[model samples]
Target: VKVFGEFEFWFALIKVVAIVAMIALGSSVIFFGFTNDWNPIGFSNLWQHGGFFPNGIGGMLLSLQMVLFAYVGIEMIGLSAGEAENPRKTIPMAIDSLAWRILIFYMGAILVILAIFPWNEVGQQGSPFVVMFERIGLREAAGIINFVVITAALSSCNAGIFSGGRLLYALSVNGYAPSPFAKLSKYGVPNRAVMATVAVCMTGVVLNYFVPDKAFQYVMAAVTFVGLMVWIAILLTQIQFRRSLTQSQVAELAYRTPWWPYSSWFALAFITLVVVLMGFHEDARIALVLGPCLLGVYLAMFYIVGLHRKTKLSREFK
Candidate 1:
């Protein structure tokens, strides 16, 4: 945690600074003609081209598959609570700030980019931020954007390694994974689990090298499908946990999701809708097939490894 925590801090800071800078720069260009010629860029670019929603409602719904993919590892925030010194205080604060972060980092950035440049002109080949900066005659700023993008990728890898090792360790301790994965290093690190995760990541890299064209699409779809299932499982678990608690016990909770059943049901329905939409997409449709097959494989592993017997024994003990 210590090694990666430092890198995560710097990477997150750079991303935040970059987003804020872009927003401010875009605002200046829109409101005060801060570009090269000192001529107001105006907001006509936002609507004059395709008048927004050019792809229609179905297109927007289909895009949610990728949008959900962007949030794939966000649940790690909750998972990390188990290791926190003060989880009750830190977890709730992190959860509450999530919406604001999404609004500012994702929505704000997209809004500014679209407002500054015509939607159609934003190419698919490179980062829109780089394009925006270069268009404004700041080539050096574009180079910096590229560097930031690299750091972002590195940050993602760092997070993946951290979360993957912890999850593997949890599984090992629960008797689902191999006992070797439960072992820790002198520094209290799950070295075996971490090595396993790195091995899996390398397999992915080799697979990508073999089929570079289709690799990302396939991986994104699979990851998004798994992420959605994880979220559903979490909500259901929370609901069951709440049902097991008395009203007074619930009242004493450190954090509670607002609207209870209503919000939970709404989120479930929305995620289901996204999954259904994935079937309509060519690349994402594979996930609908792969997901069930993967689940079946896990079920087989559970029984094959005698986990069902262990579960029965635990229940008898309880």
Candidate 2:
């Protein structure tokens, strides 16, 4: 795995730079009198307009799908175990810091945005960030934010390609996908996997040119369903991985998930609730159907491709 190679390293750097720039710009606007109505817009907004649960428990519950999606990349650090300089030491250190880092970056940023603008009023005209800057009468700040969001999208796309490529490579290795996907180039990169991922992503570019509105919505729904399925798989895999371990080996886990069976169960339940919520909203309903359908297709393919037979024969021989 060319984990820290030129492409991955540059893409990560771009994301870091964009985030730091947003933070710095936001702080300057808050601290200095960089705008006309220079008010702190303190924490009080969290409760002032219809309180914290303004949208009621239903809205909050529905929002979990987006929140969980935001945290999708959290496991990327763990996936780097294969290429880490020192797996045991570095992996533990990263895991130890992961929770706090996410809380500060994801949760903290949301809090700040809510403070600056009323939660309900957000997304009324456009992005809450853009609205806040415009409220402060900083036209330039708004433009800068637009640019930042563009960079953020590019960074996200770059990461998505990288992740999808790796996933295809893994599937190939397990014989769940074609053998060509497992082939690598002289640079130690899964070139075929990279090309395949890029090709799939380019379909979006073509759709944007042809059927922009409908295509974009369909693509977004598909992506969300795919993401939800991946999360469910990960949680299920972790459960099986833990169950298969001996008691001594289980005790040796460096970064065990908290609340054990309970937390895992709760996470699964929360995901199910999100799916149920999606069914209530017309915009998200397609995802509710698509997610399970995709999973069913995967199961059918597994059986049709003789994965079970191969595994059983291998086990018998062993």
Candidate 3:
């Protein structure tokens, strides 16, 4: 896991560098026409295709799920907080700077891509970044872009492994999962929990191997639903935590979420909107139904198996 963590760090750095390079190269193409025989490309493509809102406000609103999906990495900050050496300082800084980073990296890259190529035709062949680099007479760079993309994918997998192991370990400690998951190796690693997480993830790989086509879509739909639920839970937990604090305690806190309760409420509303919008998309609609049903089953099991009783017993003993 430690070795994987190192690789993950470098993979993330590569992704950041690749995005910055793409944005820089794309900007040159947009303004200076670095690759288009010195003829500037400009931002005409954004409006020329369908005047900014090709499919209208509804279309834009419907895309919130995909946008939210891209922001899933933000949740990793909270997941990693338990292991953070100075969470009070680091977590707050990470949370505060996330918006600016997203604007500069995600929004900036999208702006560059749209400016350099027509939106509709951008992903028709492959990545817009790949096409842009190829157009810039850097075929070698385009090939490297593919390698960078693969690393980015692997980085996501690395995150899944890290987060899943930690989460299972936490659950086990809380008496919600098998006790074996709470065990730690000599290196303080949850080897059992990590192996279990990998086994669960491997099922998906096997499914992909067999189905080849529908597996990814199905997995994504489930992931989106699970991600939405996780975000909603986090916001709810934060609201409850704030409510549990007295005014003096709140005032003494080193970190606070800006706008307090209102921002959290808005987040809940936005998540609710995304959940509703999911029903409109055929591919994602199953999640809307299945997600709640699964949650219901889990809730039922909590009582049926007397896990709640175990929790109360543990608290009393403590």
Instruction: Please state the error at residue 15 of candidate 1 in Å.
Output: 1.2
lDDT of 2 by residue, 121-230 (tens): 88889877677677776778678778767766776777777778887887787677888988878886788998899999998889798978777666665666676666
The candidate that achieves the highest lDDT relative to the unseen native structure = 1
Mark the regions of model 3 whose C-alpha exceeds 4 Å error after superposition.
310-318
- Which 10 successive residues of model 3 have the least lDDT summed? 309-318
The C-alpha TM-scores of every prediction are 0.94, 0.84, 0.94
lDDT of 1 by residue, 137-166 (tens): 788999999999998888898899999998
Q: Which ten residues in a row have the lowest lDDT in candidate 1?
A: 309-318
Predicted candidate 3 versus true structure: per-residue lDDT over 125-223, tens digit per residue:
888889889978999999999999899889988898898988888788778888899899998888999999999888788879998887876677778
lDDT (CA) per prediction: 0.87, 0.72, 0.85
lDDT of 2 at 192: 95
Going through the candidates in the order shown, the clash numbers are: 0, 0, 0
Model 1 stretches astray by more than 4 angstroms: 309-318
Estimate the TM-score for candidate 1.
Answer: 0.94
